[model samples]
Target: MNILQLSNRLGYPPKDGGAIGIYNYTKAYHDLGHDVTVLAMNTKKHFYSLSQLPDSYKSLAKINAINVDSSVSVLGALMNLFSTESYHISRFISKDYDEELKALLQNKEYDIVHLDGLHLSPYVETIRQHSKAKVAMRAHNVEYMIWERVAMNGSIWPKSAYLKLLAKRLKKYEAQRLNVYDMLVAITPEDSKIFKEDGCNIPVTVCPAGLDLDQYKVDKTKIESMSLFHLGALDWVPNQQGIKWFLSEVWPKVNSKFPELKFYIAGRNMPKNLLNMNLQNVEVVGEVESAIDFMNSKSIMLVPLLSGSGMRIKIIEGLALEKSIVTTSIGAEGINYEDGKNLLIANNPDEFVTQIERLIADREMVNDLGANARKLIENEYSNFKLVESLVEEYKKMIV
Candidate 1:
């Protein structure tokens, strides 16, 4: 099968959930000997160019990444609303991208067109109406849910109101666009429920995210120092909020109990506020070369997420690396794990402190949980297992 995938960002570095999803799927399709072509946005506001395709990658399709014009930033999104429909559409739609896609579909025959993430949903209608291929939307998350979580978790009401309006528009558009695709591929059944609740009467498949277990392995050196690690894109509100809450409320208690234990925060775009936070035991390391490296070194990974959507890839990666994970009920959502078996569940600051204390004090318990978590990941979230399921879904869509 000839597969064409459109993504909003680069998937190689695996910086965030969306990138990780694209990278794994592309690798899977390529390994199956299917012709795969990728069109990634490279949303970072910088000039990016591609040369030779990776040896693992089959074919080099169109690469349309360009500097995000300041005129097309969030301010631009607002401005485009008042401008011509072309500009309004262009705000979210990349002109070069659309032209490249049209030419590709017109020139070559593709069995499947996998539009990755709702970021590319704007182009779904155009492809469906004009192209001759089976179209599917792999929604990373209901975008509105992210904004809604941010709004509810935010402390200030005025800021929340603005975000609330943005969420409203995005939610409405997300629901309306579901009809444009033949199938909606979600990372979890919970996401499918959201689509159905929103009146999207389309075929939905649960394609959970998987990790590269080979690339990530358990490091015994990581266990030498008792450390708690949190990793994700710090620019994300949920992560930022989680850290803020942890540092303010939870960290004090944890630090007082174990003054020597280290808490490492690592991710891209670390806010100055978080970086400058003068906590005794907290160290905010901004953007490590490899998150897996940090995870391997840590004794425990903390997922104190207050509000967010979708399956937390961080949790999957941590578990895959065999790290003892201490996460909130919300943080551990989507992953099927018994509270005391695979991972520790903590709801509030008190629970978080208690779990951390138990994990730090009891080596046997932490090892048990880590071993179980690793086994669960090997059995469930391995790339081989997930890709097989995804391929089956793709076959169903084409047939």
Candidate 2:
């Protein structure tokens, strides 16, 4: 089957969740002998040259990228209030991207035209005009739900009000585009239910991010005995909010309790405030050469997400690397994880501290949790299995 995947960014060097999701699925589909071509946005926020990708990866599919500056501006955000369109979605609407997509569609026929994220929904009409392919929208997250959660978690009322405004418009935009796709490939079953509840007339499937286990190898020897870490895209509001909460409320207490234990934070776009922090034993690792290597080196994984939707790919990756993880309910939302059995789930600051301490004190429990977590990922999140199942679903839509 021929598959044309439209992405908002490049998935190679899958440092973050969004890139990991896009890259793994494409690789898995290609591995299954499917012709998969990705036309990526290559946004300035997450830019990468195609030349940087390995030759083996380049051979996987006809990977093409277009420069798209989907950055936010103070002027643009204020002007958005005068219009009915969603500011969040409108930022990705590029004429160049549309024209490139149009040209690609006209030149090469595809059985399926996959919209990787909700941000790409604006290009649906251009796709409709040029391609006879069955269009499928990969609902990475409920965009409005994420904004709502961010607003709820926010402290400043003025900023929260603006976020609420974005949420309102985003919700309306989601409802308006409900039936535009042939199917909605949701990242979680809960996400699928939410789409249906919000008047999604089309078919929605639960297709969580699948991991290629071969690419993820656990090194128990590398893990530091008294180390704790949090890794994710820091530029994202939910991540930044969660980190601030963890640092201000939770980190101090944890540090006081276990003065010997070290906390390492790693991810892209580390804020200036976090970088200038003068905390004890807290290493603000802005970005790393390898995410897996960083995860393997840490004894415990910390995901104190206050607000965000969709599956947390980092948790899955962490679990795969056999890192005993302590995350909030929001962090472990989509994964079929047994709390306390696989990974510990802690909601508030106290609970987070307790869980982290528990893992630190009990070496046996940590081993057990990591073992179970790895097993859960092995059984449930197989990339090859997920790709084959999704392809079968796509066949139905095309037929």
Candidate 3:
């Protein structure tokens, strides 16, 4: 099948979850003997140069990236208050990107045109006008749901009010744009249900992010048995909010109990407030060289997400690496993980402290949990299986 993937950002260097998700699918589709072409916007925040990518990867797909200035301007954001269009979706609409996409449709026919995220949904009309490809919106998350959670968790002041307004605008946009696609490929069954509830009449499929297990081979000998860590994109509001909650409420209790235990935080674009935080035994290492290497070096992975939607790709990668993990119910959502068997699930500060202490005291339980977590990935989240299913879905749509 000929596949054209439209993304709001580059998928190479798979540093963060979003990039990893996009890159893995493209690679899997290409490996499955499909002609896959990725036309991604090289945004200023997550820029990539085509020259930097390996020739081997380039051979898999005709990877083309166009420079897009997706930077959020205060003035533009203020102006959006008067406009009915969603600011979140509007920022991604570039004339150059549209022209490039138009040119691609004019040049070659495609069996499937997958929109990598909701940001690219605005281009569905263009895709329809240019080609007869089956348009599939691979929703990374219910875009409005994330903002709704943010608004709910925020204070009732001006910030919260503004977030609520943004959520309202995004919700309307999401609903209005629902039927424009041929199909909706949700990352989780939970998301699929939400989309249906949000009035998405199109056929929806549950296609969770899968791991290339070969890349995540775990060596127990290299593991740092005493360290705990959290890794994700810190610039995201949810991550920043979760980390703050952890430091202020949960981390202090855990640290008091285990005074020697050090918690390492790593990710891209560490905010100034987070970097300047003076929490005891908390080392904020901004952007590690390799995500797998960093995970291998840590004994336990921490995902203290307070508010977010969709699946957490880092959690899947952590489980695949056989790392003992402790996360909130929100953080572990869509993974179908057992609380005590696969990895620890904690909802509050007390539960987080208890889970951390349990892992610290019981080595055998840690090993069992890590092993179970790895097995979960092997059984349910195979990249080959997921992509094959996606291809089948595409075929069904085309027929």
Q: Between which residue pairs do clashes occur in model 2?
A: none
Residues 1-399 of candidate 1 have per-residue lDDT tens digits of 888888766566556665687788887777677788787775553223455445444343434443333234667656645653333124447777777777777877888888887768778766875677888888777778877887888558777776676677777778778888888888777888988888888888887888878877688863556788888888778888888888889998998999898888898878898888788978888989877777777788898898887788989988888888888877777787899999999989999999998987898998899899999988888776787777787787778
TM values, all candidates: 0.92, 0.98, 0.98
Least well predicted 10-residue stretch by lDDT in candidate 1: 83-92
Q: Mark the 10 consecutive residues where model 2 has the least summed lDDT.
A: 218-227
* TM-score winner, 1 or 3: 3
The digit string of per-residue lDDT tens for model 3 on 327-362 reads 988898889899999889898889999989998999
RMSD of each: 2.8, 1.0, 1.1
lDDT of 3: 0.90
Q: Specify the poorest-scoring 10-residue window by lDDT in model 3.
A: 150-159
